[model samples]
Target: MNRKLIALDLDGTTLNDVQQITSETHSVLNKLRDQGHIVSIATGRPFRNSHYYYKQLEMTTPIVNFNGAWCHNPSDKDWDYGYHKSLSRDLAISMLSLKDDPEVQLIAAESRDGIYVHGDYVPYPDFFPDGVKVSKQLSSETLLIDPTSVGVFTNTQQNQSKIEERIIKHYGEAVEVRTWGGFAPCLEIVAAGVQKAMGVERIASYYNIDRKDILAFGDEENDYEMIQYAGHGVVMKNGNDKLKVVADDLTGKTNHDNGLADYLTNYFNL
Candidate 1:
């Protein structure tokens, strides 16, 4: 194999049921490194949120976080110099216009913190827990700005699709709507063309690894494009079907079963 780099998505693929790495994964990864392969993470989480996990795995490669909004080495003291996306107050307000629709949940994201809600009237100070910073109430009356990912939640799958469709029809040109997780109808808005693929591409380009020589593994709708760009993409058995379709081969085991480690050990002869 001409593979030199590998990008692994965190959620449904790498992180298991208890939200952690498998021992077998760590062992195999060490073995891979002994053979001179590069490994990295492509995730939707922020750097702070991902630090503990990175340390736990003893990861030294760049991390693609916030769906590729940030791509830098979290291990470095300076978190400077990486790709990023910032959502403005106006976009938050525009999203607020649709809050009357019970199906829509508007959220705004800040470069530094947890999700926030958008509003007009003064909500109960306790509407959110302490530590979540609100943008502030505008004089326009009844408007509130909270940094969060807008979502459409419903008990009914069909209604979920309808709601997603609505958001796309209205904001398709403005923002990108992505279905979160495998087979989950919940939708989250991200910067247009922003996903792990963007981050992975940036890192690969910097290292001069051609797209076809890069290996990636993932298991969600967000991972679709990532698999497309990598040369030796693998999908966990539990991954979303779309991911499976593009993966060069199927690992045939889930994270709970230590599938990734098993596949690497055997396929790469590590």
Candidate 2:
């Protein structure tokens, strides 16, 4: 059998509603790995937050994190083809300015150094790495170091939409913005041309796997580019409606039902 690369999104895709990988899904992934298939994670989460899952899966492949703003092989120090794109200082300041808007609750920036939270925004300890700094005053000087990604927090969907629109209008040519609805209604801003698909392409190229030999699984707006780029893009039953329209196929079950394992079982005839 031909070796294939499998890219999976964590939240709302690989991890069930409870935020845990089911026993069945775990077994299926292990079986495929043992058979020489490449299984890796492509997620919007940062390395600090997603590293635990990578370790859990025993993945040696480079991980796609921050929605492709960062991709690197944690276990391979010699892998130098990794990518870590960040927003410009000016752009980061422009986005951080949104903290002044009444509708915008908070602004958070993630850099290689640490996470910087501005205003009333307080990230849950579980999601953020240790030594996260909180600043009541966010300025261009404070964000001089370019960040991998910036997050704009808002309470209402309307505000989230407005924030995304404003950001795109101002800096659309230099950056990309996507709303993360699975969690809070927030806008995830990254450098332009950054997407999970880009990360997958890089990893596939490194492994000498053609696009046709790649299978990707995802269930959200952030997964759009990846799903479209994959040879066989499978969307979960519980995935977004927009994703379902563009997906090559739909899984038989939702994430809660071990959809990934089920799909792979039938696809690989396991």
Best by TM-score: 2
In order, candidate lDDTs are 0.67, 0.83
lDDT of 1 by residue, 165-225 (tens): 7777877676766665433344556666677788888878767889877889887777788
Per-residue lDDT value at 224 in model 2 = 95
Clashes of each: 11, 0
Cα deviation of 247, candidate 1, in Å: 2.0
Candidate 1, residue 84: CA error in Å? Answer: 0.7
Candidate 1, position 178, lDDT = 61
Residue 114 error, candidate 2, Å: 1.3
Off by over 4 Å in 2: 122-125, 129-138
TM-scores of the candidates are 0.79, 0.92
lDDT of 2 by residue, 1-270 (tens): 789999999988999876788889989999999999899899988787788888888888898998998889999968987989988877777776677789787787878646667766553434654543323255765666888988787877567777788888888589888766654567889999899999999999999999999999998888999999999999999998998899999999999999989999999999
